[model samples]
Target: MCIGIPGKIIALHPQQADCAWADVCGMRREVNIALIAEGDRQQLIGCWVLIHVGFALSKLDEQEAQETLAALHAMEEVEADVAMFLGAGEKR
Candidate 1:
């Protein structure tokens, strides 16, 4: 049930040794992106990436990320409705 949100890589620095600064909703945060390959670097910077457990799990295109987020949100809403409906039924 761990959730990973999308962020865009902004900068890379050797100081962190294996991490990069990524922006999520305009808030900058350092996330480990050492998994990316050199040739893929350009594609990543300014593009959405799926982050998890302090690391970048995978790169996500804009459309895919939006669809994923929408699906996750819908699942949450459906689960909540089911819980509420079952609880109310039990009270009747």
Candidate 2:
């Protein structure tokens, strides 16, 4: 399944007019915002966006972004548990 991670726009890219820097789960990444770049690009700062494959798919509200982040983190925990269980079985 393809997952779109939610991130907050921190700043616009210095050199790339169509790109911006986002803070995703505490990591900074440059994402293309051309798809969602509407009016003033500077206005996008501090806004939440759903990102997939280095592109901003759509803008999101703070509440929605928080909820999505929580869900993704929970999925990570579940995946880790499943991996541990499968690895244990292989040792038998």
Candidate 3:
């Protein structure tokens, strides 16, 4: 499934209106922030937000992001356990 996960905005390029840097988990990536309006833009930096199709869907708080990430991680762990239980090879 194609998903837009929550990421924290880490940097911004004022000279490049749409360009911004964000961290997905610990991986940093560049994304566009052009959709966000003038006054609201600054507030987005250092905050968690949802990104979809290279656009910012909505802003989220750190606590919310943490919870969501935790849930996703938990699900991944469960899936891994099930795969191991079924004797599924890494190549499978």
Candidate 4:
């Protein structure tokens, strides 16, 4: 399933209007921020953004970002457990 991940904007390429550098979890990468208006672009730096398919869909506050990240981490743990269980079943 496609999920919107929370990422923090770390840098901006003003020369390049559509994309900016973002820190998703611990990894930094370029994310398209074209969905947001040019006037608001300056506010994007150091802000939390909801990302999907390499694009920033929306901006979020710090609290919401933290909560979303925690939930995602929990989901990841559940997925890992399921994979381990399936692997063990296959070996059995």
Model 4 stretches with alpha carbons more than 4 Å out: 80-92
Cα deviation at 72, candidate 3, in Å, is: 2.0
Residue-level lDDT of model 2, residues 1-92, one tens digit each, is: 56788889999999999999888877687889999999899999999999987899999999999998788777876677533322221111
Which digits, one per residue and each the tens of the lDDT, describe model 4 over residues 1-92?
A: 56787888888876798899888766676789999646867788999999887789988999999998788777776677533322221111
- For candidate 1, which ten residues in a row score worst on lDDT? 83-92
Better of 1 and 3 by lDDT: 3
TM-score of each: 0.62, 0.84, 0.68, 0.78
Residue ranges of candidate 3 with Cα displaced over 4 Å = 77-92
TM-score of 3: 0.68
Q: How does model 1 score by TM-score?
A: 0.62
Q: Give the TM-score of candidate 2.
A: 0.84
TM-score of 4: 0.78
Worst 10 residues of 3 by lDDT: 83-92
Candidate 4 local lDDT, residue 44: 84
- Measured over all alpha carbons after superposition, the RMSD of each candidate to the real structure, in angstroms, is 10.5, 8.5, 7.9, 8.5
Please tell me which predicted candidate would have the highest lDDT against the true structure: 2
* Cα error of candidate 2 at position 29, Å: 0.7
Q: Candidate 3 — what's its lDDT?
A: 0.66
Q: Once model 3 is optimally superposed onto the true structure by TM-score, how far is the C-alpha of residue 45 displaced, in angstroms? A: 1.5
- The residue-level lDDT of candidate 1 at 41 comes to 56
Ranked by lDDT, top first: 2, 4, 3, 1
lDDT, each prediction: 0.66, 0.83, 0.66, 0.76
Collision count for each candidate, in order = 0, 0, 0, 0
